[model samples]
Target: MIYTGFMFIVVGIIVLFRKIYLELQNIKIIIKIFKQQFSSTYRNNVQIKKQKHLTDLSNFIPLRSYKVYTIDQTTSLERLYMLIEKAGKTTKFSFSTYHDDESNKNYFVIDFIQPSSSIIINVEISKISHVLNDKLQELLSIIFYSSNTIYTWNYLSFPPVDFLIYDHIYSMNTDKINPKNFISLQHQFKHWYNRTFKHDENCQQIVDFVDSDGPLCSCPYRPCKFPTDTWSLSMAIMYTFHEHLQLNENPLEQCLAITKLAIIIEEGRNRQRIEALRSPSIHT
Candidate 1:
């Protein structure tokens, strides 16, 4: 009787162990299935973002009939002023600077464009006389006083604009210049990108996929997730256009890039407005 009782107790223990082992195997299988689903969802989300970027590129509008002028000391300031005056309210300004190590002075390259006239002017005021600098300052003040909207990537941090604005602040009549006329394209891009893509479903998935507790994808290539921190101009360009823009201090190139980005962002906003109008929400 005692031997039989012992045998029964042993069998019961073995049975309990086997049940626990089977449950663990089932749990492993469940985890495998979950990982597969997660990976598929992540890939799908990335693909959606890529498609949107490609769509943006396809909608690009090329600048037409624009003439670029590199104006120096010898160039006619009168004609330049006339061109600027004719440019009217559709002018954009950008600037770059070159520091002379020997002279220890910063050289300014001021570039501006008139969309209506399709004229781009690049002026080198570094080598110009004090009289010429004053005239240039006057020209800039005129743009500020006028209804023309000036665009820059980051005017505060931008060397050319910074020096121009601060150095000649007294001369430019700071009170008359409406602060609203200047558009910082970098700030605009950040706002646009954050609204359009940064907080999207795909970005969230990217956060999840790279989580320590989550399984990593087996694929060799991992698409970069949108930044959660500070957004730089280079990052903005890379994500928006899917092309790497070489960083430089060239105001002409910067201006062109800024203009293009603004147009693209504006176009996107217009489309969104149209879509919202077309698709009204049904009230329950």
Candidate 2:
């Protein structure tokens, strides 16, 4: 009987140690997976240049000049001359020229400056709708690649619409649409959160406690999941907007929101990192 009891105790010790060992191993595996995923988002160093030149042509005269220019002239000088002529006597203004040499397209920024205010127009070579759609797809692609790993890790039962939200943000900024629409979209996301986890008291409590400008506190019951794609999408949109608007609430606020959302998700899971590894799908 003594020998049997001793054997039972020994077995119990071994089982406990095994469980601890497995837990430690799981933690290590998770960390390793995260590092592998994180490195994939920025692995390729593609030297693509999307240059925008701000030209102060306030002193330049429109079509009255002796310079013979063609309507179809693709050269930078000819295009600049055409833009000046198109302004039609407007003075003291700023315009932008964009050259995407990779795509071989010319884009223009037509800004009219009155003494009191300024209005800028995004004049693309293509139709505005087409340009906006292309931008949205580009933004979505970035998010999709960035967050592919998180989707696999969680085995998400259904595809989340975070990518859509990302596209919306990019569309709003790149297409130069009214910012009120973006604000409305943000509110809509809050409403969706409310509906998705209405039954969970903890989630409801968290949602209720969220401040207007406070870091987004996701539903605790379902818990907000941060895939690498979500972060990439947010960053890409924020970075793109930062390039143009330089608005008071851009890039910084957007980046902060990303970081905060990640923390909230991580805290809810009692996990160290909120974002899963960058998706293998991302082209470095």
For candidate 1, the TM-score is 0.52
lDDT by residue for model 1 over 187-282, one digit each (tens)?
667666544543334422445333311123222122333333444655555555444444343334444556556666766754244233222231
| Maximum-lDDT candidate | 1
**Model 1 worst lDDT window (10 residues):** 212-221
What is the lDDT, from 0 to 100, of the residue 85 in candidate 1? 67
Q: Which regions in candidate 2 have their CA more than 4 angstroms from the true location?
A: 44-284
lDDT of 2 by residue, 1-284 (tens): 99999999999999999999999999999999998876664453222222222221111111111222222222344444444444433332222234446667544333333333333434345433454445433432332332121111111222224323433433433233221212122333333333433434433234454322223435432333432122232322222112122223322222223222322333342211211212222211
User: lDDT of each prediction vs. the true structure?
Assistant: 0.54, 0.34
| Model 2: lDDT of residue 139 | 30
